[model samples]
Target: MEYKIYVQNLKCGGCAKTITNKLNGIKGVSNLNIYVEDSLVILNCTEIILEKVKETLKKAGYPEDGEQNSLSSKAKSYVSCAIGNIG
Candidate 1:
């Protein structure tokens, strides 16, 4: 199934790239797309892996919308953004 998850701390192409890389690496995820402007991530995966997907997003510092965006999350996002740029 396909899922559309609105996320926070998605600011630019770097964030998008990181999100794309992180999510697409998951075992059950595929055809992932990240919309930086809208803070959206769309992907195809099994229902059973949905929570894992969300957990991965949170760990990458791009927590789903309506979830807490803590200071550490923001900092981790910045780091991820930088790494994304370098990669």
Candidate 2:
């Protein structure tokens, strides 16, 4: 099954990489794709683990679709972007 989720605070390549790395660690997750411009994440996984995926993303600072981005998250994205550029 495929899951489409829009996340907030996804500002640049670093944010995308962080999200991709975290989600890829989850069981049953496969073919993960991050669309930075759209703040969207696409993944193939079992429906049974959908909530787990969402929870994992939330923990990683990228909340699920419809969740507003907090000030801290915005700041984090900026820092992430800088760090991404440095590496």
Candidate 3:
């Protein structure tokens, strides 16, 4: 199955990298694609694995579609981007 998740605070390549790293860690995810401009994450996986992906994204500071991002959340994304760039 394929899932499309719109993640808030997904602003740059750094955010995409972070999301990719975390999601790739999951056992069943495959064909993962992160669209930074659209804030969309596309992937192939089972329904059960889909929930795990959503939870993982939320924990990683990129909440799934429908969730509002706070100012702090946006700030955190920038910080994450900076760290990702450095490392």
Candidate 4:
């Protein structure tokens, strides 16, 4: 299965390596792709373990979810508020 995680505060190679090491140790995780620009981590795993994933991400100095990308958040809010408006 493919697992998508939203990550925050990834700034450099060290941050990437840290998260990679923690996740690579997981038995069911086949692959992990981190997209820093969007603060997202795409995981290929047999099992989707959200709690452990969140914990590991926290230990790696990054947190998954509950945070939004600035531009995306603004766009979403705009779209939500614009719904049903008579233009």
Candidate 5:
């Protein structure tokens, strides 16, 4: 199945690569797409890996598009924090 996730903080191709790699690591995920301009991520995977995808992103320095900032401008900054250490 395909799941559309609101993932903010994808600043550049490097950031997108990080997200893609992390999400693709999940066993249930077949593909991943990130839209930096729209601040969204489309995940192609099974329900079984939904939580895993979130966790992976969390660990990768990008939340599922909603967090402390909650704004497009601050998304990348927050994502950097999340990726840096989550501290």
Candidate 6:
């Protein structure tokens, strides 16, 4: 199944790159696409792994839309963004 998850704190190509790398690491995930402009993460994976995907996004500081966007998450996202930019 394919899922479209709108997330928070997506800023630029750096954020997109980080999200892409993170989601693609998931075993059941494929066709990962991150639209930073829209704060969206789209991917194809098994329904069972959907929660894992969302969790991964949150851990990476890109919590799903409507979820908590805490200060810690924003900080983590900035770090992730910098790392993504470097990579």
Model 2 TM-score (2 dp): 0.81
TM-score to true structure, per model: 0.95, 0.81, 0.87, 0.65, 0.69, 0.95
lDDT of 1 by residue, 20-45 (tens): 88878889898888888899898899
* lDDT (C-alpha) at residue 60 in model 5: 62
Q: In model 3, which regions exceed 4 Å deviation? A: 68-72
Q: Comparing 1 and 2 by TM-score, which wins?
A: 1
* Model 5 lDDT at residue 55: 66
Tens digits of per-residue lDDT, candidate 3, 1-87, equal 988999898888888888888889999999999999999999999999999999888777788878766676677778777776666
Candidate 4: residue pairs that collide:
none
Instruction: Write the residue-wise lDDT of candidate 5 on 25-67 in tens digits.
Output: 7777875788877767887776877878876665565667555
Q: For model 2, how does the per-residue alpha-carbon lDDT over 1-87 read when each residue is reduced to its tens digit?
A: 888999877788888877777778888899899999999999999887888988777766777768766776667667766766666
Put down candidate 6 lDDT per residue, 1-87, tens digits, no spaces: 889999999998988999888888889898888888889888898888999999998999999999999999999999999998999
- Backbone clashes, each candidate: 0, 0, 0, 0, 2, 0
Q: Candidate 5 at 87: error in angstroms?
A: 25
Candidate 6 lDDT (Cα, 0 to 1): 0.91
lDDT for position 12 in model 1: 86
Judge candidate 5 against the unseen true structure and give its global Cα lDDT, from 0 to 1.
0.67
Candidate 3 colliding pairs: none
Backbone clashes in model 5: 2
